[model samples]
Target chain A: MRLIELQRRMAADVMRPLSSRAPGVSTYLTPNTLLTAADRLDIYHRQYWLRLLDALAEDFPALRALLGERAFSNLSKAYLASCPSKSFTLRDLGSKLPSWLKADLGRAGKYGALALELARLEWAHVEAFDAAWIPPLDSAALASGPDLRPTLQPCLRLLELSHPADEIRLAANQGTLRREKLSVGTHPAGKYFIAVHRLDGDVFYRRLEAGEFQLLRRLERGLSLGESLAGRIRGLNDPETAPSKLRTWFEAWTVLGWLGE
Target chain B: MPANKFNGFTDLGIGVGLRIPHYDHIFSQAPAVDWFEIISENFMVDGGRPLAVLDRILEQYRVVQHGVSMYFGSAGRLNREHLRRLKSLVRRTKTPWLTDHLCWGSVDGKYTHDLLPIPYTFEAAKITARKIREARDFLEVPIAVENVSSYAEFKMSQMTEWEFLGEVVERADCGVLLDVNNIYVSSRNHGFDPMAYLSAVDPARVAQFHIAGHSQFEKYTLDTHDHPVIDPVWALYAEAVARCGRTATLLEWDDRIPPFEEVHAEARKAEKYLPEAAAECA
Candidate 1:
């Protein structure tokens, strides 16, 4: 067989489930004194899966907490089987996990939406934590010019999730609030417009109103100040009173340095 | 020690892998060390703390780019985006040379993220050589391939490991980053004389050397770069220095890393084996 075919088969063999015995020694592998051909190959197989599985659990601890250890490992393994790593770095290993969780057969219905949101929230934190850093929009520029199109910081990530996943993350990170036995997959689903940003090398999240989220989203897409406000005005809960709310959100976002240009 | 055969590449003494655990000490204390080698993929992103730290580190240290993800022997196209990012890093760091493992990592667009072994056949050599040459031309820098420790050997491999490595580097006309610890680990696992393995390579083609520690179980040894270099591995490094001269040597400590002084002290251990490094130490 060609080299690629051999590699594909070897990778498949290594990624095989652990329940089975060491896979039949590939006709291609040479047996040595200490290890049979199969035993040797099994090492890589074990290392590859376990390393990635551990990485996943670290990245999405809430998801693990929600699903329990066994279910999470099994689900992550299946997720990995479908979405095996394609990035050069392991940091991108869980890039597809939120979507993978969304597509899971056992989950994705109303009851599973909280779990899916947790996965999305965790991945966003990972992405936002190291995102590009940009200086906040100049306070002087804001006072002087109304035509400014301030850009979002590279580290800034705007997430519209189905649940308040930030609450769980914040609680876990602070170590202040947690249940004795936080039951798996039991949480009320709620909508959120979260602005995940980095400050002084630490990541923080701000909960945004509907109008605020719409305005930030528009600004992120390169919309000018007037245009973003125009879009926001139409989507506001109280359009007539929105001018003050718009000023408040814009000033807060600008002060947070969520823009570059 | 004689100069390496590769032009413009000089003996850079001993260096340590720029690890995350040492970031605070590196930035604040600005520890004195020969040089630092960074895993290229970790800094490939557009913007972040990693880049900021690397930019600052570049100002202080002679940085070299060591990659883990250029699946050179893959049955696929060179990842153009990955190459682009790598070249960008090369320009920023002004690394004299670049290196990655001599193994394929992905298949059919899926990455296994491991330094897998390959067969030692003429066909694999020819194709892999072409890819390496292409990488060199496009990246606009000289490149080399590294030997990885393996638990399994391909029965279909027609030649020994050293012969296969020599074949690939010779055919590709690239340089070699000979990891002495890898040679030692493989020698123990495969039951081969490490000297014979070192003897097979053309010394002139080697542009650098790597010494690291490994985990030894009852049956086999795994190249886990967490421990300090053991006695036998240091001996093998001494032999490699004898043949390859004062090639740029890097010490890697990836896991369970110690403090900056400890890691640097571990890397400095290479100096005892490398004559020029020993003199510099004196």
Candidate 2:
């Protein structure tokens, strides 16, 4: 057989379910003294899938938690079939997961949206944690004025989420989450605008108010300081987003180094 | 220490793989590590903690780049994007040489994301060697192709593993990062004599040595890189050192990693087989 054909066959064989007859082993794989050809080939087969599976599990713990162990494992198996890792880094393993989950809910139909949102957030955390460093606006520039246009640090991720998946993610990280209790319909539900950013070489998160989230969103898009604040101020007609809140949010944002300082 | 034949690559003394578990210990204590070998793909990201941590480590120690995804034997055009990122890192670390396994890891555009074995036929060697030469010319640095542990053998493999390896390195005009433990692991898996395999390799092409552990199952041993160097593997390293004289060596403990000191001490064990380490002790 041709090299490419052989490789294609081998790739399929390794990813095949264990119960399957281990395809494409003959002609190429030799049955050595100690192990049969199929058994010998199974070692690489097991390692190939297991290692990638472990990386996927590590990358999206909350989604895994929400889906339960067995369901999540199955979901990943499907995900890899659709989107086998193309990047050299295993970090990109889950790059297509959110979309994959969105298109095909699999067994978690009712919780699909929540799972999708959680998957998005977790992937954002992965991207933000090691994203290329962009020096925040210097303290001097930040101190210059509230007049400064907003720019986000490269490591910052601003996400608008429904279902408060961050809370569940926290639970997952803390190991306090019960996989049995999690679902889209019955699980904790709420709208949350959150920031996931790295500080002092560690990843952390905090909840943001509607107005605060919007202001940061605008600023992140390279909006002027006045423009973002004015956009938020326009919402002052509502009690929750009154003009009085902008100043306090700005103070907090600047202090947290969210204002590109 | 004997200077490497290619580009005078230094024999970076016994070193441990730079792992995440030991990062705190590595960064804080600044342990007396001779050098570090990183899975080049892990640090090839665009500006994150991995790069930051690598940058900091590069400051205090000698670091070499070992890649898992080069897939030199894979059919079709090399991934230019992958090569670009690798070159950027090469510039950053100024690694004396870059190494990846001599195997085909991807087919078409899809990657299996694991080190997949290649046939040892002369046809396979001709194609693989050409790709190796292309990679060497493009990277403008010494490139060493490692022999990966394998579970299956190609029926059409017209030559032995060492013969195929020698052909690839010789035709590509590249160096060889002879991984000793892999030799032991593959020998058991394929029923080959490890000594004959070692002797078959051209000593001048041997640039570095990798010492790692393997997990033995009922039938075959898996190259887990999760345990200490077994006595047989150590003995193989001794033979490799005897053949190549002084060579750069690294200990890989990627799974269930122990403390920094423990991993370093494991790397230090290769010293007993070294004539220089013996000379110094005397």
Candidate 3:
């Protein structure tokens, strides 16, 4: 057989879903004394799923916690089967997962909305953990009114979620979250604006007020100061106190190294 | 002594894989280790903890980049973005030479992420060698291809693994990161004399050696790299050192890793095998 053809066949054989019957491996593989061709091929097949599954589990521990082991395993298998990695690095294995979860909400059942929010938050954590670092715009730089064109740091990920996924993920990290304790009664529907950002090589999360979230989202969208605050922010009820509130948020952002030029 | 024209042949004696579990100990205690072999892919990130930790390690030790995802035998052009990120890392670490597997892991742009065995045909060898050479030229660094411990062999293979390895390396004009544990694992699985595989490799091209552990199942030995270096693997390393001279050696313990002291003690055992070879290199 030709090299490419053989590789394609072997990759297909290895990547065949584990539950399905083993592919015809004896045709391409050589049998040995102890192990048959099928047995040998099974090793690679198991490794393929195990490696990708393990990587996804590491990246999405919160998702795994929410879905529990069996469901998460099924979701991972289906996700991988549908979206096998296309990147060179395994770090990118979960790059499309949030979108995939959003697209396949039915599979998540009762935990669909919460699971989707958790997936988005987890993916944001991954991005914030390793997104490129840029020098922040210092308070001095922000003081220059005429030339103050601020941008959010690359390592900052602003997420608008319908559930408090960040709190669950923190609980999961701290070993305080119980799978049994998670329920719709426990976590009522609530809107959350979370900023996941990296600072000094550590990832952190901060809950943002609706006005702050809107302003930062606008700045993240490359809106100038005039444009970012020109329109009334959706949750900013009092326009009289908006200046002081915006000033406080900008000061906090500048101090946290979240603003870049 | 072997020529190792790859990078003027520096023998970095006795190193362990830079693992995450040992980070606090490594930073706080600052042990007197010879060097570290970093999995290149782990640090191939845009920025953040991986690079931050790597920068700290670089400040203290000589770090060699050993990669697992090059997939030289994979058909198609190499991923340009991967190479660009890898080159940036190479520039950062200033690794003397870089090592990745001589196996294919991806096909048709979808990565299996597991190092899959290559059919040892002349055509496969030709393609793999070209990719290795291309990567070497682009990275502007010496490239060494490591033999992976594979379970299955291809029916279309025209040569033995050792012969295929020789053909690829000779054609590519590259160095060999000869993992002796892989030889032991492959030997047990395929019923080949491990010594024959070792002796077939050109000593002059050997740039480094990897000693690791494997798990024995009823049918085959898997490259687990979680246990201590078993006796047979150590014996293979002894023979490899005898043949290849005192090349750089690294102990790979990826799972169930012990404390830094314990892992370092396990790596330091290479000194027993390197006495004569060390003198020869000197």
Question: Best by DockQ, which number?
Answer: 3
Q: Every model's DockQ, to 2 decimals?
A: 0.69, 0.65, 0.86
After superposing candidate 3 on the true structure, give the runs of residues whose Cα lies further than 4 Å from its correct spot.
A178-184, A235-239, B1-3, B280-282
Cα DockQ of the candidate 3 complex: 0.86
| Estimated TM-score for each candidate | 0.92, 0.92, 0.97
Return the DockQ of model 1: 0.69
lDDT of model 2 at position A176: 86
In the range A174-197, model 1's lDDT, one tens digit per residue, is 653344433343333566888887
Ten-residue stretch with the least lDDT total in model 3 chain A? A179-188
lDDT string for model 3 (A1-261, tens) is 888888888888889998776657899998999888998998999999999999999999988888889999999999999999999899999989889989979777778888899899999999999988888988888877743668788899999988888899998888777767676345556788899999888888899998899888888888777777776786666779866877898899988988887
Cα lDDT tens digits, model 1, B88-176, are 99999998889999988888778888898878887788888889999999998888789989888886788898998988888889988
Question: Highest TM-score: which candidate?
Answer: 3
Question: Weakest 10 consecutive residues, lDDT, candidate 3 chain B?
Answer: B1-10
Q: Which candidate has the top score in lDDT?
A: 3
| Candidate number that wins on DockQ, 2 or 3 | 3
Error of 1 at B22 (Å): 1.0
Compared with the true structure, all predictions reach lDDT values of 0.81, 0.81, 0.89
For model 1, what is the C-alpha lDDT against the true structure?
Answer: 0.81
The root-mean-square deviation over C-alpha atoms between each candidate and the true structure, in angstroms, is 3.0, 2.9, 1.5
